[model samples]
Target: MTQDDMPRTVRTLLRELDRASLATILPAEPAGWPYASLVLVAVDHDLSPILLLSDMAEHTKAIKADGRVSLLFDGTGGLDQPLTGPRATVLGRAERIADDRLKARFLARHPDAALYAGFKDFAFYRLTVDRAHLVGGFGKIRWIEAAELVPPQAEGLAEAEAAIVEHMNADHADAIQLYATKLIGRAGDGWTMTGIDPEGIDLRRGGEVARLAFDEPLRAAGEARKALVALVGRARALP
Candidate 1:
C-alpha cells in the first residue's frame, strides 16, 4: 500500500499511543551509529510527539548534540512476533519546549512521571515531525507527510485543553462511558478522558488507551463540544 491507500485509522493509532522507541544519533566515539531506546511520549495540540528527558540520560545528551531522531511505535502485544502487527516510525527533530500546559498534558497521561518531572536535571522536548512511515501489516506500508497527520493551529485548543477536559469528564461522564464501551469497545468504569485534540479524544481506563475519533477534525472548543454531543447521540442509538 502507498500513502494514498493509508487509512485514517492509522493516524488514529498514532494519536492513541503514548510510548515509542526513539532512535537518535549517538554523538560520541560510536558517532556514526544509531542508538535506540524506549521513551514515554505524549502529543501536543498539533499532534507532535512530546518527550520528557533528563540531562543525564544518554539519549538526552545525544539529542542535545543532534536533534534529528526517529521514534518507532509498535503494536504486536510484546515483541514475540514483531513483524505481524502495525508499527510506525516518526522522523523529526526533537527540540526543547518550555510550555507548562504540554508538560501537564504529559503528566496527566503518565502520573508516575510527576516524581521526576520537577527534577533539576529533567526537561521536556517536543518533536517537530518531518515525516512518518507506517507498516500496518504485511504488505501494508506507506509514508505520510507531517502535514497530513497534524492539525493546523487552534488557539482555543492550545490554551484551554485542561478546562475542556475537566468539563467533559465532569459533565459528560455518561457520554464518556458510552464512548468507551459502545463505540470504541473497551470495558471498565475506569474510562477517563486523558486528552483531546482536533482529531480525537483519548480514553484511558486503568492506563489502557482507546481513542474515539471525531467524524471530522475540530478547531474550536465549541466545535468539539458539538461533536461530543453528536457522537453520544449515535452511541445511544447503537443497538
Candidate 2:
C-alpha cells in the first residue's frame, strides 16, 4: 500500500488495540540464542507502549541488557474467528524513566494498574517507536514511518477547546439531544465537549457514551460556538 493509506490504517490499529504484548529479545545466555517474553502494556499519548515491570522480572533484566524490542498488538485475540480485524507490530528501543510526571500521565489512563505502580520493584518503561507495520484487514498492509504516523499538536487549540465545552454544556443542550436522536439514534439528556483540535471535536452525550468527532474543521472558537447554537435552533425549529 502507498504511504497515503498508512495513516487511516494506523488510526484503526490504535482504536482497536487497547492492550499489547511487548517482546524483549534477550542476549544469548550460556545455553546460546536469545528468548522472547510477552508483557501486557498500555499505549501512551505518543503511541509508545507503557510497560510496568519489576526489577526481578526476567524480561526487565533482558531489556536492560539489550534495549531492542518489538510490540505486537493483535485485535483478533478475543474473537473466535481468525484475522477478523487488524494486527500491528511496532519496533523500537525501550527506556526506563523515574520521572513522576510521566508516570502520572500513564497511570491516569491505566488506573487498574495502580496496584503495581507503587511497588518498589515495579518501574515504568516506554518504547520509543522507530518503525511500524500495520495490516488493516487481508489485502491492506503498509509500513508506517514514525514521522508520518504521529499527530502533531494542534495550533491555537486551548481557547477553542475551552469555548467548545462551555457552549456545548450551556446553550446547546437541545442540539446535543438532537445529535443523540438523529445521529446516534438514542435519547440523551445532556452533553459534554471534552477536547477539540484541527481534526475534530470530541463530545460526550449522556452517560459515558462513545466519543464523537466533527468532520469539518471548526474555524475558530467563536465560529464553533455560533455553529452549535445555530444547530440547536434549527433542530428545535424542525417538525
Candidate 3:
C-alpha cells in the first residue's frame, strides 16, 4: 500500500484487533521511566482507542499521574518475520471518560470484561490521539496525523449505532451470517454483529472476529438500512 493509504490501514488495525500493548510513563522518583503492559482495547466512533483500566493497576495509576501514553497494535502474528508485517504505534494522552455508548462498544468486543466492568475501581478511558506511526512491512511506513487517522464525525450514525447493532443481531441474523461467510470469506457458524460504525461492521462467533467494510461510508442513520440491504444482495449474488 502507498503512504496515502496508510490511514485506512491503521483504522482497520485498530478496529479489528482486540488487544494492544499499552505504554505509560512511570510516576515515581525517576519519573521518565517507561512501562508497558498488555491491554484489551476497543475504538469509539471516531476511531479513538478506548481502554477499561483499574485504578489498582500500575498502568492505570501511572495514567492518573501522567496521562501521556502510547499503544502498540501488532498485526504480525503468525508471520515468519514479525517486522515484515503491519503494526502501528498510537501516541496520545488518555483521560477517563464516562460515556455509556462507548463503554457498550468496548464490552461488545470483549464480553468477558463485562464480568468486572462494573467494579468500582474499573473505569473507561479514551486516548486523545495526537498522531500514529504505521509500519506496513519493508519500505511502507508513514506518519498519520489524528485527522487522517479518524474519519469525519458521524453524529447521526453514532447515536443510532447501538440500535442498529441490536436490530441486525435480533432481526437479521441470517443476513449477518451471510455477511461473514460470503462477503468476508470467513466460514463460521453462529456469527453475530458486535458493533457497527460508518466504515464497517464488526462480527464475532466464539473467539474469532472479522470486519466487513462498506463500499462507501454511511453518513447518517437512515443510510444504514439501504447500505446493509445492498450488502445482502451482493453477498447473495456471490458464487
Candidate 4:
C-alpha cells in the first residue's frame, strides 16, 4: 500500500506530534457550537492523545459537560505551502485520567507540564479516538476508522515500559544513537529512548523528539527486542 493509504503512517504522524488544535462543544452556546484552541499533547500507550487541561479553560469546562471532542494535527510543511502536506482530525470523547503512570508518561514528553501538573485546577485527559478524517495533500483524503487510528495495545506491555526504557538507555545507548542518526536521519549522540508501545518507539534528544515505527506492530517484549535488533541491523547497513 502507498504511504497515504497505510493506517500505520497516520498513527505514526500522530504519535510523533506534540501539539494539536483541540475542538470542543461550547456548552453555553445556543447551538452547542465548536470552539477550537491550541493544546499541548502527548501520545498515550493506547495510541490516544493525552492533554493537560485547566479546569478554568472554556474548552476544558465544555469537555467536562460534553465529552465529545476533536483534535486537528496538520503536518503541512508551512502556511506558504499549505496544501502540499497532510492533516488529520481525530474524533473522540475526552476523559480525565488520574493514573500516576499515565501522568508520568505524559510528563516525560512534556516536562513543562510539571509546573502546573500538581495544581488542583489542572488535570490530564485522554481522547478516546472514535474515528478520524485524514487529508493527505490534495487528492488523498479518507475517513479512517478509529481502529485504524487507535490500535490495540499488547497484553502486559504497559507494565514493561519502564524496564524497556531503562534497558535501552542504560545498556544500549549506542544503539539508540545509531537508530536516531542512521535510520531516522537525526544527527545527535544524546538520544534517549523514552517510551515504546505496540505502535512504535519514542526517542528524545535535547528538545527534539523522534519516533521509530516497527515494520509491524509488536505484542510483547520479545517482539520488541527482535524489532529493535533488526532496526539496528538495518541502520548499520545504511552506509
- For candidate 3, lDDT tens digit of each residue in 152-209? 5555987888888899999999999999999989986899888888898899888888
The full ranking of all candidates by TM-score, starting with the best, is 3, 1, 4, 2
Ranking by lDDT: 3, 4, 1, 2
Candidate 4 structure quality by residue, lDDT tens digits, 51-120: 9999999999899899999999877744687986888888999999888778877887777779999999
Per-model TM values vs. the true structure: 0.89, 0.63, 0.95, 0.88
Clashes of each: 0, 0, 0, 0
Query: Of the candidates shown, which would achieve the greatest lDDT relative to the real structure?
Result: 3
The lDDT values for all models are 0.83, 0.62, 0.91, 0.84
Model 2, stretches more than 4 Å misplaced?
1-3, 28-36, 77-81, 155-239
Q: Work out candidate 4's RMSD over C-alphas.
A: 2.4
lDDT agreement of model 4 with the native = 0.84
The digit string of per-residue lDDT tens for model 2 on 1-239 reads 46586765664464334456767765546322455566656554456667788898777887888888877777665566657567888888999977664475455435557888898898999888888888767777777888876753444544355555556657766666675565545565665554444444444542243333344545544456555555456556666
Error of 2 at 159 (Å): 14
CA lDDT for candidate 2? 0.62
Residue pairs of candidate 3 with colliding backbone atoms: none
Model 2 CA RMSD to the hidden true structure, in angstroms: 6.0
TM-score for candidate 3:
0.95
